[model samples]
Target: MSDEPERQIKALTGALMEVYETLRLICLHLPVPIQLPRGPEYDLNTLVPAVSRLIEIIGDQPMREDEQSLVWGSALNWTAAAKLYSRYLLTGGDFVSRLELELLIQTAGEGLIIYLDGPDSTTQE
Candidate 1:
């Protein structure tokens, strides 16, 4: 949301149009054959949209227990996990919120995508 171009982040779910575009720019500038921390696995095609959807869904609350678990395992009771805003509440909040944030970050890292060399270089997602 910040107006400063250097610090704006639109990587989370349902990222603003600007943010998504920024992500593409970042990927384009990365060293050819983007390498992730976990592995070299990368896909430019579905990476952006997948990460966006995951963040949007996880950040939105009142989600079913199953949904939360799918996002990330629930270490504690989902019923008492509190609201989504609670992620910053209670002095950094509980495990669930923290877990969601961690998972989101991990997904961002997993977003290593290929840079298209030409029109025929990239595949449809």
Candidate 2:
């Protein structure tokens, strides 16, 4: 019983890492001098669904109202990040800029660490 939360957190962390890797790969391979979207068909709309899926995968439990809000906020941040990346790509910015990409990856990795290590109410203090 005591191990359940730990196991769940571990699984969530793994899933997040997988998603982050996919995002990193996309960023790496996105064409240089990106073709900017001219219509609704090729907009950043796709990122919203991805962010929702990520939140669904990482956070599936019922939560207090406040916690639910916080989760939604985090999801929004993820969505915004995706949109920003898309914009950067569309503007012909270097998609594989080493410094920026490294920072993004490092931030995601640190986030995974925090998610894994954060205190769980189910665990003993």
lDDT of 2 by residue, 24-91 (tens): 34233323211222322333465457555645543444444333334334454545545545554456
Q: Candidate 2 — which pairs collide?
A: none
TM-score for each model:
0.25, 0.36
How many steric overlaps are in each model, in order?
1, 0
In angstroms, the error of model 2 at 117 is 1.9
Clash list (residue pairs), candidate 1: 13-56
**For model 1, what is the C-alpha lDDT against the true structure?**
0.34
lDDT by residue (tens digit), candidate 1, 19-72: 334344443343332221121343323443344443444434454443333332
Candidate 2 stretches greater than 4 Å from native: 1-47, 52-60, 63-74, 94-109, 120-125
